[model samples]
Target chain A: MTSKWFLKSTGTAAALSSLVLFLYANLRQPTLTEQMLPVHLKIFELDRTPQAHEQQAVLAVLKQQLGVTAVSFSQEGKTFSVTYCPDKITAEKLRAAASLNEAFKVSEKTFPPSPACPVPPLDEVKHKVLGVLRIF
Target chain B: MRKFVLYFVLALAVGMSLTACNDDKVLYEIDPNSLYSRLGGFDAISAVTDQFLANVAADNVINARFAATVANPARLQLLRNNLVDQICEAAGGPCRYKGLNMRAAHTGMNITEQEFNALVADLVAALNRFNVPEKEKNELLGILGPMKPDIVGR
Candidate 1:
């Protein structure tokens, strides 16, 4: 009987704690980014040195993508960067589109491949978590 | 009766005050050859704003200051809209700048004089890229120059 009472007390405390947390999360004011969907820049390494035509083609592919805002190749033409709305398109989608051509294969099998500075995936996680926590 | 005369006088006074308020709402008179017109109106202003943003992105001196803004598309677009509106309104165009004043916007940023000058230089470069005339460019710069005090070293 004593064990049962202890279990009940712990359960009650846990429920109350959850209620407080839920209220707090739902009540706080939304941040500036929370009000609008955020944009991200994804850079990809090209498989081979890009020719002028290949550079233009890659830019065209990314630019024609739904949420892409800006696309530019690196000075060396070995990598390119795309600024896009993640809510509308993903780096994977961009990789697929850019690799459709036989000549230029993008090394983006891993959504964010290595060889450049990363913006930290933690920001993406936080953006997604905020989206889930937001009640209204 | 005396009451009728008093009511009539009160109505006349109230009518006059309302007319005065209406005068304040009259449309602003813009000169026929205003800078806004010379700059080719809204489209030209928008083009210049886009070029300026590109220039700022490429500028190393001031690019770091705007990294966060460029990272967020919404914020970037807001900055673009505010810039276009500010320039339009300053040039006596049919636009109203509803954003925060220069001091308020740059208060916590602690912008340096060099950074501020770099920004102006970027804008000037953009105007030059568009081949804006010397007279028109100087006129626009003259209009925006006064905000330097409010924006720099704050």
Candidate 2:
């Protein structure tokens, strides 16, 4: 009976040890979801033709302060559309920064949710011309 | 009975030793640059971007905007180059981006967050078309996902 009791105790200790080890290992490794998600920013309807160098400088400042990456720009006559990552900066902050700078204008806009996949209908040759014209 | 106990103790010791040995090593550590290489380098990036842009052009909500700017093939090429540079650089690859800032380049065009999200959806599709693994895709998107704040405006 004593030996059986010892065996049961040993098994319980082993199980506890295994549980502790499992927790410790998990605690050591961080999950990917724990990291911060990236923000997307878009600036639209700017003068895309003359190529505003000063505006570019302002954008550089915003990128540095906010950790922005992947910017996109489009021009339709004098209007330009630009998009980038906002990192951790808030929209109010971006607005305040742009407001302080005379070279750029913040359009009345709202943050839009990103799509999970690219749109396909626009790629068709028949729709290409019309599609290109519309974004402008 | 004593022999069985001894054998059990020995097995336990061996198991503990093996666990200790593995404790020093990590189970997964993905190399970011190598992940980019597997995605087909610049060519693959360009292809995906091309497909993405094409999709953007078709999206009714933002098709007008994408079409206006990316109409010219030459302009599209420039845009593709800039985008590829940014993606490659973000993915820990060897590439320097020489494109304009997001806000300055986008000022006055009036892009809504919804439109930007649509573009991202198209991008995700492109990545899927290229068969990028989920982990790597998430990693790449993590690099690109932050751009939402800069792209959405509000």
Candidate 1 lDDT tens digits, A1-136:
9999999888766755454444444554442223333445555667888778877777787779998755545456775555566889987898888775556677631232212112234544544554566585
Q: Candidate 2, residues B1-154: lDDT per residue as tens digits?
A: 7855765566566545544533111343435557557786656765566556544543456756645244343344345556766786676555556566665556555678887787788788768866888888898888788776666663
TM-score of each: 0.50, 0.42
How would the docking of model 2 be graded?
A: incorrect
Best by TM-score: 1
**What digit string (tens of lDDT, one per residue) describes model 1 on residues B37-125?**
89987778876876677566545566556666655554565566567778988988766674678877777667888988888988888
* Candidate 2 stretches greater than 4 Å from native: A1-136, B1-33
Give me the overall lDDT of model 1. Answer: 0.66
In candidate 1, stretches whose alpha carbon ends up further than 4 angstroms from where it belongs are A1-136, B1-30
Global lDDT of model 2: 0.52
Top candidate on DockQ is 1
